[model samples]
Target: MPGNDVRFLLVDDIRENLVALEALLRRDGLEIHTAQSAAQALELMLVNDYALAFLDVHMPETDGYELAELMRGAERTRRLPIIFVTAADMDETRRFRGYEAGAVDFIFKPIDPVILKSKSEVFFQLGCQARDLARQRDEMRAMALHRDQAMARLKAHADNSPLATVELDCDLNLRVWSQGAERIFGHKTRDMLGRPVAGTRWLSEETIHLLRGWIADDEGQDSAPRYTTEAIAFHAGGHEIACELYASSLCEPEGQHRSLTLQVLDISERRQAEAMRSLLIGELNHRIKNTLANVQAIARQTLRQSTGLEDFDRSFSGRLQALSRAHSILSDATWSSAPLDDLIADQIKAGTLDGDRLRQSGPKVQISPENMLRLALTLHELGTNAQKYGALSRSGGEVHLSWRCEGEGLVLQWQERGGPHVTPPVRTGFGHTLIGASAGGQDGSVDVDWQPEGVIWTIRLTQGVTPVSGDAPVQKALTSVTVTEESLVGRRILMIEDEPLVALDLTFELEDVGAEVVAVARTLRDALREAADQMVDLALLDGNLGGEKVDAVAEILSRRGIPFCFVSGYGPEHLPAGFRTVPIVQKPVDPARLLSVLHQISVTPVAETL
Candidate 1:
């Protein structure tokens, strides 16, 4: 079927003439509309966009000449092609009238079919061509509009991007500078555009040569689309920044270079982060090796002191736990220091004797993690002896523990009373050797008074003491203690660990030791909230919570006087500066070590926060 716009109009007074004219013009892809009068043809012309109009010269009311003149007067059909037909005799005057009335061509009645068809075909082909031309114009206009919109979007993306977008002419003169370029190099678009790139401090002479080489080399091959490289760029302030550059050249079809585009990305922060990661890895490696060596030392020492497998297991396990306890305290203080009182309480168990049988008196003191572990093991041996043969073995027995600062040194005393008669051991065991070694530290002294009533052990440690000035002795007298894991039993503990597996393992470990895990937190906000809870008795903290330091939480815990220890794979350097003295437990935790820390730092029921 023909398109509605491809219609042709035929008007005549006689039906035969109109039919003959329509049959001559009709063909595929063409529609013919017939009208018996000029009024009917005018109506059809107003409704349809006709390609051509054939008018009858001899009409009833309006002749072809008159109709053609009228058609030219109207805007819609003003440019429409018209052909006139008639049976009137030929004359110059009539022909002049027909030509003056806007007829493009004329045909007489009884016209030859060949002449009629040939003349109408010319108008038909012209109409088709004109229609195609109009459609092509519309399509080209739409395409132009789309191209403009796409360019606008591309420009917006380039201007807003963080990567520096730069365009330079073949002469290395800047042609374009985006907003990101201004931010990265600290030069405005106006200042950079049309300026020689070599004039800027951002790019070196060698870099300019390389950029030029890219354009020169691009003419040879099309394999490598983009050239990537790293370079040192200078900021406007004269400082150096690391940058990664991605460059590509734009050229004509004949390989003539038009311009070059360079995308610059600042990688200064990324480089710093990578360096820090390497440092941390090295430090971690060193710490791991040191820890393994220490563990080997403990195992060897325990083996030498053992009488059998059972003895080795008991001694080795106890020592490791004591070490772990010291670490836990240090971790709490971010591996800085441990308290003297906590270290003392960790070794002695209340259930080993009557609740009132033990007494403690000491001013608050802080010691290094190394010293804390040393003192803990020494006290553990002493407590073991008391439980086996001294005051702790009998219900009516009594023990008194006390410490005081003396001339840049510390004096710790252990006295037992109301037990079986006392006597010196036939052989010096590992326990006695450990206790004696405690005094050998810092050129200190040891004195054991084997009195008939019980025994008295005193040691003077000359090093690793930070005394609290004007702090009167804290005299703690605890009673009604339970028998099992009494130091940690019923204690409300707050735990902060980012790792889910570690937190779950630790929760079970604490619970197994009779400590109540009041709450567990994996983030800074949660840790702070739990730390502020008054019901919290103690805390175990992971030094780093997903790259953030737990300084604020530690501060809250310290201010509240709630005892806490740290668990970390990192050393003191990674710890919170303010809480460096807190105990630290290394990663790949030995449960015994954690248990030891809990026991060592436990406080009595009557103990107050401050």
Candidate 2:
């Protein structure tokens, strides 16, 4: 009700007196109803709610005191404030009777308007306060009803959700458990409710303790805290499963009485996917590293005794293209072998030998993967050599490339003519080694007859397993460069590589440049122990070791103040924050680039005595 609804009743046997009383007690927030007699006043009291009643003491049949008594008898108006105004000579006895008849106060015949109105105002204000209190109580009840309905809906939704929901009290004991929680943990709510989480074997001892600490402590945070982690959980039959937990505290908006809500999800499939992903990653890393090692070998061989970069670029690209073609064919064959014609066609395009100057006749034969790559590179090298000085150097020159099956084997020959005179190279280059390796298996041999008019090169292969080969032409020692001047001379290096071939290639490369490899580590464990125990000036590391990150090993090396570089197919983004400053080398490494990096970290001593 509005504040102006505070009503008052005025009564007297005289009409003018009733009007006078109404006017005297009038206020902006009060509605006054006047009556000239006790009967009309009683009727008004029954019809309307009133804050106070003003009545005259002297009346005909029933006086103001009697009406007040009547109001007091009825329960509805019993507490209403009543004030008596009278002209009769007043004494303490009459006042006592008025007070006993439920009169709150008395006014004399010549009423002091100030005292009447002030005293009347106090009762009006109390009635207003009482009304406001009752209204507030009703509104509070309504709001509480709505809040309960919303909570019921939320509880129903949470119970139906896939995530396991568990509620814990401030004492770290389970209070409420949902059906979803039972589904995940394999226990019914009846057995677990009101129980301490620490008592269950669902979580390990350490995890249980961790949870207790998290529940009781949020680092003194004033708001509800949240935490997420992956850990082990047990099934109803005692089988352990991987699960992720989302933990949080719930309470009022002001952050009181925090209760823990734990949501669990089964991560067994995700964990399995992660494991498979790791295995694939390791296998991919192995393939890439091995391929890179092969590339590295090819680079060394192609650049062997080269005079300049330009002189070697064409040779190296041609060799790499041949290797790519061989790989494409082998990949098509599922790494089994490559048809001999496919390789020849690849070289014909790569060597620019597709015109009349090139002629060929061959029966298709399947060469094993090892022999296929070597054969491709060997043919490429021969073509490049011929282009520079042999038959292809002259306008009238012609070349014949042919192969045929012989007694349980194959014979391939390249005959050149009508060009500059032919002569054998003084020292064996990459070409010689590649040809030798292509023919290295099972009585296979490569022969070059250098004649004045041309060169006749023949390669024979026996049918059997083509053995895996290693390295290009062995690097020649540089007598012109001394130990004191060599960049890596006397430097003890630690190598961490997961692939065997890549590791060996890197080690051989380092040894060729005068660096002493102190130890080789293939796993994080081995890397750490090696880093701690070995004495080395520098280290080489792979980004991943045995399917784990190398950052921990890198951290150890960093704390020891030993410099290192990462060499892996995994990129620089995979490097941890603390190790981002370190150098990185991707797979299929460029030999010159590797050399430059090695040189930057190698040990160089100046001649002090000289």
Least accurate 10 contiguous residues by lDDT in model 2 = 473-482
lDDT of 1 by residue, 1-610 (tens): 3553467889988998877777777688788889999999899888888888888888877888889999999999999988788788879998899888888888888888899888888887888888898789888989999999998988888878879999888789998889888888787888789889899766888889988888877754554357889988887778888999998888757677667899999899999999989998997797668667767976887788789997887667666666666666677776576788766554543233344677889899888755676777677677777888899888788888888888777888989998899988888877787778754365888889999898998888787789877778898865633433345778899889999999999898788768899888999888888888657878888988988989898888888778888888777778888776676767757566576666655643212322
Error (Å) of candidate 1 at residue 201 is 3.1
lDDT for 4 in candidate 1 is 30
lDDT of 2 by residue, 345-414 (tens): 6566443453457777665567787777767777877877787878888898978888776666678898
Candidate 2: lDDT of 6? 79
Residue 164 CA error for candidate 1 (Å)? 4.2
Global lDDT scores for all candidate models: 0.79, 0.76
Q: How well does each candidate superpose onto the true structure, as a TM-score?
A: 0.57, 0.40
Winning model by TM-score:
1
**How far is 345's C-alpha from truth in model 2 (Å)?**
46
lDDT of 1: 0.79
- Candidate 2, superposed: residue stretches over 4 Å from native: 1-5, 36-48, 58-62, 91-97, 169-171, 182-190, 213-217, 235-242, 249-259, 266-610
After superposing candidate 1 on the true structure, give the runs of residues whose Cα lies further than 4 Å from its correct spot: 4-7, 35-48, 57-76, 86-122, 145-164, 178-191, 222-225, 234-240, 301-312, 325-610
